[model samples]
Target: MPEFNAPLRDMRFVLHQVFQGPALWARLPALAGTVDADTADAILEEAAKITGQLLAPLNRSGDEQGVTFAAGEVRTPDGFKQAWQTFREGGWVGLAGNPEHGGMGMPKMLAVQFEEMLYAANCSFSLYSALSAGCCLAIDAHASEALKAIYLPQLYSGQWGGTMCLTEPHAGTDLGIIRSKAEPYADGSYRVSGTKIFITGGEQDLTENIIHLVLAKLPDAPAGPKGISLFLVPKYLVNADGSLGERNAASCGSLEHKMGIKASATCVMNFDGATGYLVGEPNKGLAAMFTMMNYERLSIGIQGIGCAEASYQNAARYARDRLQSRAPTGAQAREKPADPIIVHPDVRRMLLTMRALTEGGRAFATYVGLQLDTAKYAEDPDERDAAQRLVALLTPVAKAFFTDTGLESCVLGQQVFGGHGYIREWGQEQLVRDVRIAQIYEGTNGIQALDLLGRKVVADGGQSLKLFAAQIRSFCASEPPYADAVLHALGQLESLSQWLGERASSDANAIGAASVEYLQLFGYVAYAYMWSRMAAVAKAQRKQEPDFHDAKLGTAAFYFERLLPRILSLEASIRAGSSSLFQLSAEQF
Candidate 1:
């Protein structure tokens, strides 16, 4: 079986040297004095231990055993319950939750590292905690004070798990036409009725109760998405005194047999007039739910990074140990009958691609986390607004690009293993199966691309894109290594954005036709920017940590030379426009 060890050194490098997370935290009034460099490092160390020791061992076994569902109750695999108890006691579920509600109050910058570790160790195990953390965020952000007082503490404490119920039987991406209904009652509560599918942690044995944040429409609400509202529905009703009351009308109808992450209970949840309270304003559920959805979008994106990291580790180890053939130039290892596969040029290409994409993605994720932290905690209004715009521009790119390349990286890792990669025992196949879902879920990558191109960029007249470009230009002004390459890529992105904006005026279908490719082009440019920043830091600090910084510089060079040029093909495809795509009619096939 493959093993996972958190890349603690690289993680620290990104957090401290590249992003300067501790310095930013000290400047934010809400985060200052909460956590410093030493404390954050200790937290990362402890997280690595828990994930590597407790969760990594269970990954394969959990997949083999999976989850058992009987009589409407779901039980997790062996050792999961015990592990959950230990994890809860450690207060890991609420690592980035609000401190006023019994959470540890860590910044997203530090929390993202822990999240990557959690998913890398075990994707299924991570979902239970991730959902709860996202739930706590939504409730704290939009829920009433009474609701927050009642729900936030338990959810953050891990005594109760959480889930977001959005996809219905008929509605997948078109949430505006959802059939779920919320009827207002006289006692200031509502009766929720709906059947939600693909609900993760909707029913699990790890927690005492499951808190579901369901989306439904009120009777007097407007049409389409504006009619939607958010509700807090728990499996078991809670009394005013904070004790568990009678069981609510919510129940798990069944579990879905999935391709991967089988240990997670993908539930078919049925709500039959379940007692639920309104969270935030009525007829504003989609907005309220976006609080959780955006968080989950980024969280799911990290899921991709985690899987890729684990796959790369196994493949790299295999390359070093598994001898295949002699090097073409000469025999590097004369003692052995054949040289290790790492000596092969093709194998080196695959490994370097994996390393470059994974490492570049790590830097990018930390950068996004910094933007998130700045948006929430920064004292200056202008600074916060700028960070918010960047977050809006980058979140979709993070989700789509990370997973899109994440799958590619995993496939490359598997290819390095040759025949053994196809076997189940090697664990490479499982990583491939598990990471594939990140591209589909939390709003499919296609939808994410459309949001990035149509809503974030073109809808704002390319202002958001320009704002982000200016940031990159400011960095390039310092003339760092690969600065010209990064600037050139940024220029391509700007020209493409203007082209799409002009096309949108004349052609209605132009945005959708070019969205996916546009997002890809945008992602490559953003990663190039990330690589440039890291290269600058690595050059300045190479003497301090020669081996680590040298590897970083090498990977950055590989990214610039070999990977960044893919944007050219993407640019050409985007310029082709919607004419080719619409040429074929429905009957032509």
Candidate 2:
């Protein structure tokens, strides 16, 4: 079995050094009194312990055993229930929740790293808490005081898990076509009826109850997407005094047999006139769901980073220990039959590729996390507005690019392990299988590209993109060592955005054809900026922390040299326009 060690050192480097997390926390009034560098480090260290010790042990076994669904109740693999209890008791489920609702209310910048650790330890298990946390966010943001008071505390306490029920048998990405209906009653509740498929943690033995944030249409509602509304449907109805009442009408029809994260119960939820309370306004369910979906999108993006970290750790260790044919120079381990595989240049290239991408991705995720924090907590309205726009623009990128690079890194990690990587015991194959879902779900990467380009970028008249470009230009002007290369890449992305904006006005298919490549190009440039920032920080700290700083600089160099060059190809593809994509008619294939 491969060993799992949390990358606490690199995490600290990104948080405290690269991002100057502690100083930023001190500056934010919301976090100044309650959090600091020490507290942040302590939180991360404890999280590492919980994830590495409590969660990691269950991963392989859980995957092997999977979850069992029978007679509408789902049974998670052994140790999952116990582990979940331990996890909740540690206050992890409420780590970033509202303090008034039995939560710690930590900053997102801090909370996200813990999330990364959770995903690294067990993506399947992470979904249970992640979905719950997202549900809490939506409730806190849009639900009435009565609803928040009744549900938030219990959900945060982890006695009840949560799920977002949006997709159905016929409607996956297109929420406009969903047929679920809600009928209001005299007691200020609605009877919700729908069959929501692909509901993660929809029905589980881990928590006493499961809360579902469902989307459906009210009677006489408007047509299409605007006709939808959001509802809170629970597995067991809550009594007046907060006690559990009779079972609700919701039931799990079945659990999905998936390629990965098998231990997570992805259920087909059937809500037959289930009691549901209105979350926000009527006929505006999609907006309410966006609150949760956006949160899940970022969380899912971190899932990619976490899985890549695991793959890299195992592969790095394997390369160091696995004996292979003698190196081109000579055998470094003469006592053994051959030197360790790390001696080979090709193997080194693969490992460095993994390291560079994983590390760069980590920094980029952190940057986005900070934006989330600023958007929520900044005192100045203008500052908050800018942060919010940036968040809206980049959330899709974080979700898509991180997962895309994550899968690529995992493949490279498996390459380093040779045949053992393909085998089950090594766990590298599992990483590949598990990380694959992040790309498809939380909105497919294609959908994410459309959102980023069509909605966030073009729809706003490129205002958000311009705001983002200004920040990049400001950073580049500050004269980091790789500033020129970073600026060049940014120019490429900016020009493409301008060109697409002009072309899209006339051609509807333009956004669709160029979205994926545009998103990838944007992702590469973002990572490059992150690398430049990291290298600058490392260069400044080289004397005091020689080894650590040198490694940072080296990895940044590798990224710029090998990975950042992909921007050129992406730019070429983006400039090719949408004509070629449309030229081949549906029947031509």
Can you write out model 2's per-residue Cα lDDT over 1-589, one digit (the tens) per residue?
8767789999998988988888888888988987899999899999999999999989999999999988888899999999999999989989989999888988888888899999888989999999999999999999999999999999999998999999999999999999999999998999999899999999999888889999999999998899999999999999999999999999999888999999999999999999999999999778988999999999999999999999999999999999999999987899999999999999999989888888888898889888988888889999999999999999999999989989998899999999889999998998999999999998999999999999998899999999998998898888997999999988888889999999999999999999999999999999999999999989988999899999989988988998899988988888888888778789998
- Compared with the true structure, model 1 gives a TM-score of 0.99
Can you list the residue pairs that collide in candidate 2? 228-285, 229-285
Writing each residue's lDDT as its tens digit, candidate 1 over 1-589 gives: 7899999999999999999999999989899989999999999999999999999999999999999999999999999999999999899999999999989999998998899999899999999999999999999999999999999899888999999999998999999999999999999999999999999999999999999999999988898999999999999999989999999999999999999998999999999999999999999999999999999999999998999999999999999999987999999999999999999989989999999988888989999999999999998999999999999989999999889988999999999999999999999999999999999999999999999999999999888888899889998999999999999999999999999999999999999999999999998899999999999999999999999999999999899999999999999999988898878899998
| Model 2 TM-score, 2 decimals | 0.99
C-alpha TM-scores of all predictions: 0.99, 0.99
Off by over 4 Å in 2: none
What's the lDDT for all of these models? Answer: 0.94, 0.92
Question: Which residues of candidate 1, in runs, are more than 4 Å off?
Answer: none
